[model samples]
Target: MGSELRQAFSVIRKAPELISPAAPTPKEFKKLSDIDDQEGLKFHVPSLFFYKNSPSPALEGKDPVKVIREALSKALVFYYPLAGRLREGDNRKLLVDCNGEGILFTEADANVKLEHFGDEIQVPCPYLDQLLYNVPGSDGTLGCPLLLIQVTRLLCGGFILGLRFIHTICDGFGFMQFLKAVEEMTNGANSPSLTPVWQREILNARDPPRITRIHHEFEPVKNSRDIFLNMNLDDMAHKSFYFGPKEIASLRHQLPFHLQNCSRFELITAWLWRCRTIALEPDPDEIVRLSFTASARGKHYNQLIPPGYYGNAFVYPALCSKADDLCRNPLEYAVELVKKAKAEINEEYVRSVADLMVIRGRPKYTSEGYFIVSDNTRTGFDEVDLGWGKPVFGGIAGALLIISFYLKYQKRDGEIGSMVPICLPLSTMEKFQEEMKKMTEAPM
Candidate 1:
């Protein structure tokens, strides 16, 4: 009986670290070419936020070293593949690879203090205000020299864990999965339940693939027409806001022609398209697109991948409308355009996208006008149940204004979804809020 108990205890034993919590940057970084990845070239990384009370009730009494070490151990287990990237030949590819690593953690230097920006801080990036633009060198690695954990004197305490992962290895979903697994492992799980999908052949570029000419369909940036369509167009300022149950119910009643109310995702997307066109103030001849990703692991693509498999298991589906066409059209027409975009999600389209990337010889390209709408409501945010408690709140630390969409549940006043947190450009956020308020308050 005593031996058995000891064996059980061994499973959750704490891991020891030779390097202290406050180590400076590592000496060498791996290069991007070694990874042979297009995503390696793009260094935008996402941040995941969580709020929690410290393990000890006394906030100032808590040990930053202990907390950081525990977090590092958990990160090591969850991001084991990152260590593999460190071993790769090219330091350039390793630089952008989030998987490549020696763990770097920092606590507040004795002289430095944590500052609270309130709701304003909620919208801004926590470290250096760089947000996703913090670039890793040609190598896919970043130097995370410091980790500032706020020790609230009274009740307030917790951490905003930020990871600057190379976007090429995984997307937000994959990152969330990694975080969840780390939390689980810290609580004594041997291995993460997630079966990371690595079947590269399924999405491999076609051999001698015939590429399509439809790339020119997008709007080109002025002063740099040489850049592909929608690459670095004039910056359109926007703002961020969310829709809750109240606002959505109002929209159901406002629309004429027998409204077919859709899911929160479909409804919000349509509303965005409608409002965006209004903001564009565009020519009648140009086409504007509303785009979103379709999950690639459905019944049709089941043969291509298993359900738990992961990678970029998504394909972009776009809806095109003449700028004026969307503005003059009824709300239902916008809804239908989103529905049509949904239909474009298929195996063939996914394959074609892969083939196109390959045929183009995987050239480095940048674009700003493409809007990608993604819903993370289904992502296992709530699944991060550590022994202490579920996260009081969780979200993305910064909103990428250029071309990104992310949605998550909002918890407020002991209720979820007073409004779902939707991210958008700062310029358009107020209008979005007003629209949501009007829609939610409108009669059902």
Candidate 2:
């Protein structure tokens, strides 16, 4: 069946073109925030969203590619910076030249229906490259288009939206804000309900750049036996794990009564860290690190970040432990470590990180003994309505070597949970599965 579907699936696309703003925009240079230009965020991230055919009589014969193309131009009027190309300045800092150059856009048609993918479309999608073509010389951090979008019309009238955006420009929430603006344009709105804001200067490093806190996420670690440093990409296997109410209940059962109230993000991060460490079988005394980002917005910080401020306003807090300690400890032990790492992301911590970036030349996150997980359950990817009701599947297209995403998923029986995608060495994948099964099958 897979081979037959593969032979039947073909995406016929027109020559890609640039779609500029419908109206004139400012032609000036806008500097990005310190958090935005970090080494870790200089790459492009790809995502996919599948929309079913709308049954509304008012929208019967519309072409999604054309609709989105026109809406994208209109939306670019407010988000004009995204229409510009990135430029590098002194100290390897990034700034956008608002030249109104526009973004890369493509229109395509697929021979297969959305159902051919699966009843519940998950990550590690096989046709990701076909749906979102990576144009030559377009994936660089400098002198590259900030956003690339593709709209593919399926045989069943359903459409898939593929997106590739440079992470140095915005985070997940900021990208969603821009996408929502396009959806507003498709819905016949003259302007976005929420105005766009690009106040990157607010998160800049201080004059003296004082590093008050120790940021373990960016710490320099010299390990001769680093598992990631010696990994072969060809030997890695990607797998998706679903955790619903039952799975959560079983995992919670393994925890002590006092730690039963841990949030789902903390629980899953701790559990996965333990299982992955066991699978790798690192030295007993080797250090293993788990890193995740925490948002620095909202009233808790006295509104330091204004509403509509779409930039990278998050901090990567990391926790580390000896491999033997992490694998042998109780579930609650790792849970407490996860909680401690998350609790350290306050206003001061964020400022301190900016200082560290400037002090350390914007070093990338620690790669030795490192694992990163991102929680996208509340990112509002699934709620995007582009004249079609909502997407059947909306999130990242696949998993990276060391990074995993926690995406929101709903089962056939209407049970909502998280679908996490993980990539491990082929030799260790079986052991990883065994450890995961042990967690989810614990006695209730």
Candidate 3:
């Protein structure tokens, strides 16, 4: 077969400069307020991709930049035991820059006209917005330790693979335990069979970080630098909104008659929080806020941790109301206010937000203050096989400015629902796809 497809395209053109000298930053790791589970805070920024077919001929002579610098030095020494390094407080032995990391591959040469399978697995998507931008920083270059691309088929004869991650260092079961430690270092397995647990002073937070008001629901923004010292929104030009799937199943069957309890991810996040309060038409006494992401280890906040714990488990409930009480609610009262904002995940509100990030000194929450729901449909994307298979598409990358909702649920011919994939703000995606085709037509 053409000498085994020129020896697997010479082992993927020498695997990205042998994995860019196994890069690692955050000034060289250790900084979730000096680790030890003060809510274990780093290492889960992955960028995966692996579609096959195009490499044959015993993988030809081999030499794509020395097989991408030997697969980025075996993925930067296999992300040193699944990432860890944050030190400073109680002088926990000094090392704080933040988050262990390394991984970024790219090789785009397709032009569009796509659709294949004869050779199997294909989804090209013309260099998917340049392999999504990988954005996460606070020193650690934000995030992107996995991005293997190789779609060379003129327009669509074969080749497709894409994966990306960085939802604050792991969730979705600590990112599948760092993808089962990169599949035991791609099978050569000398170690990393799995067992990485940090400890972050047992998810700390209340030493001296209290605010007190607790009720009046949500208004706190007095001076967290006054919401980025006020506005700029990139001088206007990032508005997109599309709601299909039959207008997300007619707003989840009429938002359960208005929050009596309609689910479909809380009525498509309560009609995207009433379409960002009717596109900031806001005024019903303003005060709007709505955040999402509550997973401190599920099963009703699983006893806080200690079993292969990874980092930044989860939190950010937020959920306030009033822009005409979330645009005259009805989708089951905005899915019972998104199930009362996921009953605010407990464990003392994730150790009082890591003691309010050590009383607000460890700060870093700017995607424009929140509305970021990512559920990657139970994060598995075809259960990332890796033995040399299972991946036609995966997501999350450099996502900024919020309104990022990714909730996959593949399959399609045999049947499987939810797919979501929204990332709006491209100038309000054609009036959000004309109010999502007037809620997926049909009701005449």
Residue-level lDDT of model 1, residues 63-119, one tens digit each, is 444544565555554344433333333322223233334443333221111123233
Model 2 per-residue lDDT tens digits across residues 186-252: 8889999999999998899999999998777888665625766667888889888888888888888
TM-score of 2: 0.98
Q: Give the Cα error of residue 301 in candidate 3, in Å.
A: 26
Q: How accurate locally, in lDDT, is each candidate?
A: 0.48, 0.88, 0.47
Runs in model 2 with CA error above 4 Å? 55-57
lDDT of 3 by residue, 1-444 (tens): 333432332212212321332454333554442212332233333333434433334334333323433443453454442333233446333233334433444454444322332221212222344333333332342333433333233243334444454434445566566665555544445445666665655665555666332322223542222232334655333322334455566666554344534556666776766765555454575556666766677567667676677655666656666667667765466567678767755766666666555654554444332355655557665455444345454443323345444435344353455444343444554555555555565352
Candidate 3's displacement at residue 83, Å, is 9.9
Judged by lDDT against the true structure, how good is candidate 2? Answer: 0.88
Query: Which segments of model 1 are wrong by more than 4 Å?
Result: 1-41, 54-79, 84-100, 109-157, 195-197, 210-238, 256-261, 363-369, 418-443
Query: How many pairs of residues collide in model 2?
Result: 0
- Which candidate, 1 or 2, has the higher TM-score? 2
Q: Rank order by lDDT, top first?
A: 2, 1, 3
